[model samples]
Target chain A: MTELKLDQALIKKVISATQNGLPICERPYQRIAEQLGIGEDELIELMQKMLSAGLIRRVGLVPNHYALGYRFNLMTVWDVADQSILALGEKVGQLDFVSHCYQRPRQEPDWHYNLFAMVHGRDEQEVEQQVAQIKQLLGDACRAMTQLNSLKILKKTGLRIRS
Target chain B: MKLSEQDRQLLNRVQQDFPLHPEPFKVLSDQLGVPEQEILDRLRSLEQQNAISRFGAVFNHHRAGASTLAALAIPEHEIEEVAAFVSSFAEVNHNYQREHEFNLWFVVNATDQKGVEKVLNQISATYEYPLLDLPMVKGYHIDLGFPLW
Candidate 1:
């Protein structure tokens, strides 16, 4: 069960501390708790609470895609039927290679990409093949598609939330 | 550096359903038949190798703040200069160059919509390029839980 209401202050503290990572140790949360001056049990309880509330997406390892030999990151966008997005989006999101998928606003005139999914692979061909598979899955419902290959990483930082 | 069988397994296992305990490492050790100390050390070393970006909670941006995926068609000549200016902002996280006329794309997250707009306006004015602020209308596949192996 999720928390009825999240404790805002505690959420900020836990997130800020673990923003970088949960320090690798015998008792990682315990170490963080000691710094926060809360008991290990309390820290764990708070973490569990946040995790349940859907605030914390996942409490686990995030392997660097590039390091894992997933050098190709294609920002694949599709113009799918608006009514069918909910049903179709969930299916696409479930794909193993598609790391992130969302239906974003369509900036008309210049941009009309609504459904966005991040496809990752060891190389461009692999990524394209995956995209083709998605295209096959989409069938006629899929209008236009574009594969935006990442050229360079100008910056990479996590989202900061201040309470 | 090649990954040992144990390392590969650990990497695959930790991607999803990681243990939730005072000593999660102990749980991993118990399951994998490895020492808890080794689990911790291996994770640390993997992190050091930049293989594991981090082992922690991923916050939901929609719940926590106002975020948008904005793109700018920066002139080829001004790519470097423009990228520097955009990446300078703290709110601007995950900036990257893509192969397109509307080349540079970045995600901006702020505490509120006002803050998000402020960043968008600044970039729009500075670069003199139309910024396509494409905020998520519906989130279908936000979770990226999958097996690495």
Candidate 2:
């Protein structure tokens, strides 16, 4: 699809309208459109434009991984040689068990990790095994690694924008 | 919670994509070979069971607005007070106390980069702790759904 200029006003309205999940009904889109004071086709067209513009990632069911029994979700950070980060990051991202992977900036002295990957598993052993695979992939390039296990959740409301 | 084979299939299907049609659930019903009413019922039940947290659009925060992953090192005794203060901001979402020296980690999101910086600066000034602000340099993956067997 060709790149299209997004209408910010319409996009904001659509996001504010659907941020709290779509209504579970036969004509969900139509209902949302009606509430937003637009026709169903117009609403869908705006959504399509946003999706094409990479504003909306996906429209789907977001599962609660922890509630689904994948109890251990660890943010595994690795400090690998700068030269090999791009290659190693690609390999680590392809792992079925690694849901999110990115190369973030490193805070020197205090933080040396540049590669971050999120590993999910049913138990500690499973998470450890997954982390081991990443370690093995990095091999000599990986100088240090740490698993940040969440001890407590202080807040967890997903992304929101003021209407 | 024990998941039936059908439940697993439904979960796997919906996570990948949801149709953007007048009757979106009905499209899913056709694809999954389950009746429309039954699919709706299953989704409602799964949400009630907390298996499905949300069933809608997942916006790309970086594209829609601005955000960054930030962490602060809070003294053990003062974690509670520090966390409460940090969580008071509407822009601070997904705050957690992790097992690390940089214990208190959270995501700050706002409509623009200036808004995000204002929140972070305010929080930093409020507390006299070391704050590490890390933003994404590159992303290797996007919209990859988890597969449940």
Candidate 3:
């Protein structure tokens, strides 16, 4: 596992500057480098290092799923056997329809679900069909599951670095 | 939003693995066989149309700071009030009202574990209901860039 020294002042400055999104220009990197008072090559090298270190996931367009016709976004929660979760979670995540899958801490008594899978679809029927497929895949290992459909988006913003 | 065939091609091509060259748009133009200006224009138009939320580096929240998915079961009558109160905090970036018992859900992110805890503690103290804090143990399918067409 490669550890990134995110605490470095240069790295923090770069993250803060480019986190909102890069400038749209013919020489975007150069423009950013100029703004940071660093040479373009040096800026690019630091960015490449960050990308390699897994600090920056990618440098690309982030499409709005809703605008792209994926209207229904459901966060499906599952309570699978603790012993089988790792294997089952991997299987669930491999499904083409499942966008995000994770094993999260489960709150006892009221919340027993440990596995969460995010499913996106164009409509209710499509989402239900996808959820059913997950249920079948889990089989008897899954005890209880529920789908939480997003009713409204209250707030959505990019990360703001507190200086 | 309706998109032309050319628009679809340009979007699908530029979604991920964008070139890091000096003239990145020119590189894309060479590969996609579209004029560099046209590609730029289309991207700008798409962004204006809300088709593209952002076009830049996407950071890994866990790598940069501490974050968690939290939920609170706010009563229907006070949903708006609670939602507004939660949204007031700078740490609460993505907040949503979901159809479940734990209706009010949001993601809290901060520079460190203590910062994250501070935000969570404040929210918990304000609300009479129990807050369910679910931090990720492990994430699969983190490579996001899904096909848009």
Best lDDT among the predictions, by candidate number: 2
Candidate 1 lDDT by residue in tens digits, B1-149: 45777888888888766777998889988998999888888888888888887777788888777899999998899999999999999999899999998999999999889999999999887779878999988787675455665
Q: Please give the lDDT score at residue B100 for candidate 1.
A: 92
C-alpha lDDT (0 to 100) for residue B83 of candidate 3: 94
Candidate 2: count of backbone clashes, pairs at least 3 residues apart or interchain: 0
User: What tens digits encode model 2's per-residue C-alpha lDDT throughout A1-163?
Assistant: 4334566787888999999888777888888999999999888888877877888888888888889898898999999899999999999988888888989899977788999999899999999999999999999999999999999989998777987
Interface RMSD, Å, model 3: 1.5
Q: What is the lDDT of residue B6 in candidate 3?
A: 85
Cα lDDT of model 3 by residue, B50-140, tens digit: 9888888888888878999999998899999989999999999999999998999999999898988998888778888878999989987
The candidates' DockQ values read 0.77, 0.79, 0.73
What are the runs in model 3 whose C-alpha is more than 4 Å off?
A: A1-7
Order the candidates by TM-score, highest first: 2, 1, 3
Question: Candidates sorted by DockQ, descending order?
Answer: 2, 1, 3
Q: Which residue pairs of candidate 3 clash?
A: none
Candidate 1 off by > 4 Å: A1-4
Worst lDDT 10-window in candidate 2 chain A: A1-10
